[model samples]
Target: MPRTQAGDPLTERTIRVLDAVLDDFGGRRFAVRDWTGRRHDPPGPAEFELILTGPGSLRAMFFPLNDRTFGEAYVTRAIDVEGDLVAAMRVAYTIIETRVPAAVRARQLRLLLTLPRAGTGRPRELRARRGGRAHSVARDRRVNDFHYSRSNDFYRLWLDEWMAYTCGYFRTDADSLDAAQVQKFDLVCRKLRLREGDRLLDVGCGWGGLAIHAARHYGAVVHAVTNSTAQAELAAERVAAAGLAGRCRIELTDFRALDDTRRYDHVSSVGLVEHLGPAVWRTYLAKVWRLLEPGGTLLNHGMTGKAGEPVGSPFLDAYVFPDARLMTIGATVRAAEDAGFEILDVENLRRHYARTIRAWRERLDAAEAEAVALVGDRTVRVYRIYFAGLEHAYRRGRINLHQTLLQKSPAGRTDLPMSREDWYAPPQR
Candidate 1:
C-alpha cells in the first residue's frame, strides 16, 4: 500500500474533502480510510469503516454523486464498507439529511475534481439493459427478465422454502422466515375469503409459492402469471411437483396481457404493483376489477412510499427494478376506488417487512461466496446494499408494506364477515 507522506498533494486534498464532509454531517460512528492506507478515525467508536481503495474512490463516489453513485461505487469496488453495512447506511442517511450550503458543495466538487479519476473500469453490468418504451409489454418483459432471471438457485439460497420475495406477516417477532411467509399466504387467503372450487388469479406470482399454497390449502383453481421466463418455468415445476398441475397453472405472460373475459373468484397482486409505475395505477386497478367476478375479492399487496418521500431513487431504478415506481397508500386506495373497487381493509406491515429484509440480508451475507459464484461480486454487492438500505428505509417509516383488501361489489354488497375475527382465527390442523 502506498503511504502518503507529509506535504503530499493527494493526501492534502483527500483530508480537506474528508474534513468538509465530516464537518457538514457530524459523522461520529464510522471511520474513513483513504487510498494511501491512512485512517481517519471518527470522534466516537466506529461501527463501520468506509475504505477508499484508490484515489478515484472518493471521486467515483462523490463526483456527480446522487443516491445512486454510492451504490455504484460499492458494487464496482471503488468504495467498500467493512463491518455493519446497515449501520454504515444509517450514518449515510443521516449525512444525506444534513443540509450543505451550495457554496460548500461547489467547493467540495472542485476539490474532488482535482483528485485523479479512479477509473470506474469497464462498467460492470450493474444495471438493467432493457430497451423499448417504459411499461410497455415488451419493455416490462425485459425489465422483469433482468431482475428475476438472474438465478433461481441464487434466490433459493436466501428466500424461504416457499421462495416468497415479498413481506412476510410475522404474528410475533419469534416467527421464522418460513413460518412468517406461510402465515402471509394464509393471511391473504383469509382476507380474500378463498374457498374450494373458486377460481383464483395470482398476478406476478414469483415462484408459485402463494398459488400452490392457495390451491393445496384452499382448494382453489389457481392461474398464475409472470413475465420472467425463468420464474414461470420454475413455478410450473413447483406446481407440478406439488401435484397441483390440475389445480394450478403458471403462465409466462404479463398481467396487462391477461384475457379480460375470464373472471376470477379472487385476485392477488403481491409485490407486483411496484413495477406498474404510478402512471399505470389506474389501468392496473381497472384491469383487475374487470377480471374479478361480482363480489370477488382482490388483495393488492406491495410497498408504498411515504407521503413526502422522493418518487424514486436512481440506483433502484437503474439496477434493481427498472421503471418501478412506488405510490402512497392514499393514492393507491383512490385508484382502486376509482376503478370501482371498494376498499375493505388496509394493513401496514412496515415492521414486518423490515424484519423480513433483515433476515434476507443476513442469509445473503452467510451465502456470500455462493452468491458471488452465482451472480458475480458486483451483482452480490448490488443486492447487499439494496437489501440493507431497504431494511433501513422500512425501519424508519420512509416506506411501508400495505396489504389492501378490495371488493368488486355486485349490487353494492360486500359479503365480508361482520368483523375481522375470522382473519385472526387459528389455522386448522
Candidate 2:
C-alpha cells in the first residue's frame, strides 16, 4: 500500500477524479471511506458506503474500470461495502458505463497511474483456473464439478427444499422459495404436458429435483443426467427415499454421451444449454431433437443475454461455471428451429428469477456462519457476492431467464392445449 503524502499532487488528482466520476453518475447516493477514515459523501441520502482498505484499493477498483475489477476489489477485501451491495454495484456499473469528457478522462488516467497497480493479493482460494480447451467434455465435467460438487450441505444452506438450482417461477411476491421452486418444476411438467408412463430426459439435472417431482406427482418415468458426482449420488438417494427408484433414474453422465437409440417422450434441459457453448448450439439442439419422440416437446430453460454483452464478468467466467456462455433468446430459437423443431413458446422469467436470487441471497446471508463452516470463508464470500451480483444483473436486464418450448411436430401434429390456461390453472381435485 502506498502512502499519500500531504499536499501531494496525486492526492488532489484522486479527489478530483472521484468528484468528476461521482457527478457523472448524477451524484449517486453512495459514500466512500478512505483508509485514513476520511469520508466522501454524496449530495443526497446515501444507501451504501465503500470503505477502502488502503491507498492501493483505489488502484484495484478503477485501474481498468471494469466489472471484474470492482468485483475483485470487494472479494479481496481491498474495499468493503456496507449496506445495499446491489445499490453500490449499480453506482459502480453506471460509472463504468458513463462517458466523460476527454479532459476528465485524462485526469482519471493520471490518478490511476499514481496509485499502486496491485492490491494485497486476492482472496484465499478464490480463483478457479481450469486447463484444456473451453467447453470440452472433459473440461466441462471439471467445471461442473468445481461449482456443483462443493458439498451438497453447503447448497442446502441457501437453496429450497428441493434444491432446484436454476430459476424458480414465482407467481407473486408472497411465493416462498420452496413453493416457487415446486411451481417451477410443475411448470416444466405442464409445459411438456408430461403424463403417466411418459419417458422423460432431464439433462444437466441438478440434484434431480425435477425428476423426483415429475415421477412422484406426474407419474413420468424420468432419466436424469448430470456430470456431478455428489449430485448424482444425493439425487439417487432422494429418489429412493421417495419410493420412486423404479421410475426415476439419476445417471452421472454428460448429455452428449447418451446413446441416440434410447429415446424419450419429452426432453427437458433446464440450466444446461449455457454450458454447451454457442458454437455447439446447433448440435446441442440436434441431440435433444434426436432423443425426443415425434410430437414430443422440449423445455429449454437457461440464462440469456443480449448480443455484444460479455458472457459475464471475468470473475464469474473464471470462478463460476467456467464453460458457460449466454446467448440471446433469438439465437437460441433460431438454433432450435434449425434443429427441426417447431417453436411453441418463449417466456422470459427475468423478474421471477430476480425474486428467486433475492431469496437465495437472503437465505445465504442468514446462514453465512453455517456456509463458512461447511465450505470455508472464501467460498461463502464468493457465493454471497455471486448471488448479489446475479440478482442485480437480472433486475437490470443485463441478463435473463428464458423458458422456451419446442416440439418435434410429426407431420405438423401438436399436443399442446389451445391456451396457456392449462399450464397455469389449478390442479383438479
Candidate 3:
C-alpha cells in the first residue's frame, strides 16, 4: 500500500479500497500502480507491474472487473502492463478470480464516483453482429469472415511454414515451432495409420497443413474443407505449389455442407470443436462419423473447458473468435460415442499448448512492426493479449487440449494392432 500522504485522503481511500478487494490475492508476484505514478509494491519480489493511466482507466478495469473490460482497457491504452506481460497476466487473472465482498463493491463504486469519468473507449463489435441465432450457417459464415478474413500474411508472420493454426506437440521447450508442427501433423497422420492411395478428409483444415502433410508425407489422397474464404484460397495455392494438385483437393465450404456421396478412410478435425456450440456436439460428431469409412479412425483435436474453470473469454469471443465455445472433455467423448464412434484414445496436450502459445506470443512480439503493418496496431494488440491470456489459461488448467481418437469400428473389428506399442515405437532401420 502507498504511504499515507498528509492531507491526501483520496489517495489513502483508493489504496485502502483496492488493497482490501485484492486481499485474497496472496501470491502477489506483481505490483499495481495507480494513475498518479505512485507505485504500490507487494510485500515481495515483483516480476511485472500493472499501470493504470488515469481515473477512467481504473473505472474501466475494476467497475465490472472481468476479462472483457480489462481487455478493453489494454486495447485502448487506458491500462498498461509493464515488464513481463505473461507475469502481469498471471497477477491480473488472480485478481479476476478474487471475489470482492458486497461492501467492497459498494465502496469501489462510491470512490469511482469522485474520480473523473472519461475515455473508457468504445465497446467491441459484439460477436461480429447480434440478433441472429447463434451458430447458424449464415451467422457462422459472417463470424468466420470477421475472425479469419484478416490478411493471411498477418497469420503467416507467426505461424509455422505449414501455417498450422492448431496446437503443436513439443518434446521440450527448445523445439522450434516448425519442428513441433511437423511432429503434430505427422502424429495425427500416424494415428490414423495412413497409407498410399487411402482417402483422408480434413474438416476445419486451417491453411491445409494437415491435408498437405497427409498427401506429401503419407501419400494419402486428401480432401480438405474450410469455411474461411481467405483460408480456402491460400490453401488451394499451397496445394498446387506442392505439386499434389491431382491428389489433393481443397473445398471452400463448411463441413456441414459436404454431400453424403463421399466417405473417407480417415477424418481429421483439428482446432474446430471449440468454434461449435455444445448443443451441436452430437450433430458435428455424427457428421464426422458419417464421413468416415467403417474401421477408419477419426482424429478430433481441440481445446475444451474444465469443469470448474471460467466459462469463456468475452474478449476472445468479441475480438478473436466470435463463435468459439468450449465443451468439457467428458461431454465431447460422450457426444462422439453417441454419434457411433467408439472411443479409442484420449490424450491431453495442455503443456504443449502452453509452449505453442508462448512461442506465438514471443514470435509476434519480435515481429511487432511487420504484424502491425500487415494487420494494423489494434489487431496486433488484441492478439498479443489473446496469446498471453491463453498461455495463462493453459498453465492454470482452465482449458485443455484433447486429441480424441475415435473409430467407425464394426464390433470386434478395428484394423490391426490391439496395443498402442506401434503408436510410439522407434522407426525401422
Clashing pairs in 1: 56-118
lDDT of each: 0.85, 0.82, 0.81
TM-score of each: 0.95, 0.93, 0.93
lDDT string, candidate 3, 250-277, tens digits: 9988877888879889888899899997
RMSD of each: 2.6, 3.2, 2.4
User: Which candidate ranks first by TM-score, i.e. highest?
Assistant: 1
Question: Between candidates 1 and 2, which one is better according to lDDT?
Answer: 1
Rank by lDDT, highest first: 1, 2, 3
By TM-score rank, best first, the candidates go 1, 2, 3
Q: Model 3: runs farther than 4 Å from truth?
A: 1-13, 27-29, 33-36, 99-114, 123-127, 425-429
Candidate 1 per-residue lDDT over residues 172-268, each given as its tens digit = 8699999999999999999988899999999999999999999999999999999999899999999989999999999999888889899999999
Give candidate 1's error at residue 156 in angstroms. Answer: 0.9
- Backbone collision count in every prediction? 1, 0, 0
